[model samples]
Target: MPKNKVYIFDTTLRDGEQVPGCKLNTKEKIEIALALEELGVDIIEAGFPISSPGDFKSVSEIGAVIKNAVICGLSRAVQKDIEVAAEALKTAKRSRIHTGIGTSDFHIKSKFNSTREDILQRATQCVKWARNFTDDVEFYAEDAGRTDNEYLARVVEAVIAAGATTVNIPDTTGYCLPHQYGEKIAYLINNVPNIDKAVISCHCHNDLGLATANSIAGAMNGARQIECTINGLGERAGNTSLEEVVMVINQHHSLGFYTDIKTQQLNPLSRLVSDTMRMPVQPNKAIVGANAFSHSSGIHQDGFLKDAQTYEIINPEQVGADGSKIVLTARSGRSALAHRFQKLGFQFNRNDIDVLYEQFLKVADRKKEVEDEDLKVLANQYQTATV
Candidate 1:
């Protein structure tokens, strides 16, 4: 891949499915995996093959059918896990075996009850084991956001030397602020001798509500691949939302990086994953949300009525949404009412609008909002009185 291109590694099937009660069967996983492929993600992290029989089956079947995007199967640092992942990805025309271990002292001491050196060795060995399957192997440093920058460079350097083509530095706990995470990636780029040999990937969580920010930081600071999930679905506060990151890069072209993602597919794919996974996307969620481009406040509605760009930075059509909306409500102003009136085939002058606005407000106060029909009723009443 070109250095200017940011590879989108979607783990909606792996980390996304980790959400409680969001478990998808093998068929559902394949259905979403196909959508992700068409959405233009560079890699699809299918599942952790060693975790269960169902996961292994999902990974294998997705690998068999997905011909475009690289199908990746996740595994821990254990030899058996690596072996299972490799077998599951054997059918992929393009495939990657993603394997890694924790590098931070917290995960080392508490999660593994092991030392830093031992964990580093396991991380290196896992890369070597994964490489036996394909040349496109990716190694993730779990909880990498908290891993010491100096020690993290050493771990990253070691894996790159072990034939790992991509190294994922993840904020497993979603703990790092944007600057702190960017500095970590920058540290590796400056300190690691063989850093150029592998693609640096960012996997961030949203526990701190900074996943998209941190992922953008990593990319701006030199990481080329971002591992994210659709609708931001994942453990706890969820993963970095794919739609957010993609749209951010789309809107901010000065960032000097681009991804192959079809921005239009983002909203549809987000809904597909949410529906198939049985996860309810928050109405106000970024990019793909129903209200992402909807305006309701009087001030906002007025500005939106004059020009959508006044309130919306992203055009709704850019992300596959229907379009911007000026939601009717008691808080809405006359400008909004007039715009709705025009849409409903009425053209009232300023004085005429003021008269209608008064009645609209009265009905809005009683009903919480004035519907289009109600606006027509109010407008016709004024016309009838004048006649």
Candidate 2:
């Protein structure tokens, strides 16, 4: 991979499905896996094979069909988990086994009641076991955001030496700020002796609503892969949003990084995942959100009417969205109302709009938004009064 290339690792089938009530069956998982491939994701984490029989079947079936992108299965540091993950990925043209353990003291002491040395050994052994079945092995440091840098670097080095091709540093609890996460990635890059041997991946959560920001920070600090999900779906708040991160790297040229993602497929794929998982994308969410390209404020609408660049940084059509909307609300100005009417095929002049503006505002005040039907009624009422 090029130094500036960032790999897109989509874990919607595994992590995103972990969200409550977002469970997907084999067919749904395969549907998303194929779509992710078409969207140009570098890797698809099909499922955690050892978690359930259904998940095992989904991973196996997705691995069997997906040809271009690498199919991966999640596993713990346990031997059986690695074995099951390997079996699930047997049919993939490209396959990866992602296995790891907790490296943070909080998890080490509380979750496993083990010391650093024991955990480090377990991490190395798991990677070695994964290597037995496939060369594309990724090791994740669970709760790495909270793990101490020196100790984290040690485990990272040990894993790479043990045959891991990618190392994931996850902000498991969505705890780290951008600067903190960036510094952590930088620390590993500078301190780890064999850091260049494998790719550093960022897996951030959105509890603080900073998953996208933190993931960008990681990429800026030399992490080459971003682990994300469609529509930001995951356990708790969510993981880093795939569309948000992909667009961020694309729009900001100064970042000097790029991914293989097909930007135009973002919205359609977001909707597919949302519909398949029975989860609604928040209207206000970034990128593929319903309100992402909408102009509602009077000031914004006026500026957007004059020049779209003034209010919108991203074109709606760039991400497969319908188009920019001039939503008529009480906050809208006469310019926006005129624009909406013009779009509705009404040739209302400034004087005609001025006459109808009062009634438009009356209806706008009564309703949250004045629709085209309301504008037609107002226009007809104005023409009747004049006649």
Candidate 3:
């Protein structure tokens, strides 16, 4: 059977930059945009053009230089917002206008102080206005995770009719469980008559730490595009991580999905975004974290040394990361100690290691981790005693 193509829509410059103090200048945005193009992102959501003068300039600059990837500018359902986005994306080879309005009752009654019918009309109208500027238009139903599935389908169907090529169902508040998000996508696929006319997209947030899982669930059900960021950087918790979603589909072949992303660039691009945005990726972050491939636990280290596949599903070099590290710590066993010693050019026999293990444990217990210099001291002292 043929694998389905899952379009990677990267929103690092737009949504990911929304994190407080993670803002990027136009030069930084362009740099990341070109890298994202090289990384084979299908669509790069450059910025919200109407948000500010700086944002409009960034989107315009990114659109002018980004040739291969579809450069996209975001906007609200307002006409002025869509117009600004269209003007900003005028120089791109391929451009998309992403415009949408909130659909949930919380947004409808409290946020917009309007009824569902008015919001629905605004949603379709925005797509129509966006269609005037570009053939590629993506309509998002903000907070669709909490929206009624039936009403959400109506909004989706209307947007497609209004010339939306992609329909984004965002877990704006990150409120849905994996099952709920998947079932919601399935509901639209089953209920909407014109659903096949447009691609279903998953734009999930990581408030509950289920953004990646929810995105996968949506894809499994019917979504063909996943909107995500480089390092899961965004408002509140974060957005679905680009590395996580791409690697997940790569590892789980039974899902029968494939993306055009270059796997090796994941780490380099991740670090670039993290540094440029000044947001630190958590050490335990999946795929691109500092400790993602480092083994320190004695059981895990021994298993990893014996066979890398025993503890690591991903080879570090596969993602352009440095080789796996065997960090020596208090919990490390003799096998790990021997391996580290071997790496340091020491030819310790099993008996040599047996004697050194006692002293190594004493040093390890005194510190958080046993450094190479500490190991050398132990090796030298043991050799002196044996001689």
Q: Look at candidate 3 and tell me the lDDT of residue 325.
A: 88
Estimated TM-score for each candidate: 0.97, 0.98, 0.99
Highest TM-score against the true fold, candidate = 3
Report residue 246 deviation for candidate 2 (angstroms): 0.4
**True-structure lDDT of candidate 3:** 0.94
lDDT string for model 2 (106-220, tens) is 9999999999999999999999999999999999999999999999999999999999999999999999999999999999999999999999999999999999999999999
Question: What's the ranking of the predictions by lDDT, best on top?
Answer: 2, 3, 1
- Clashing residue pairs, candidate 2? none
| lDDT agreement with native, every candidate | 0.91, 0.94, 0.94
Weakest 10 consecutive residues, lDDT, candidate 1? 1-10
Model 1 residue runs over 4 Å out of place are 1-3
Segments in model 2 whose C-alpha atoms lie over 4 Å from true places: 1-3
- Model 1 lDDT at residue 215: 98
Q: Please give the TM-score that candidate 3 achieves against the real structure.
A: 0.99
Greater TM-score among 1 and 3 belongs to 3
- Tell me how many clashing residue pairs each candidate has: 0, 0, 0
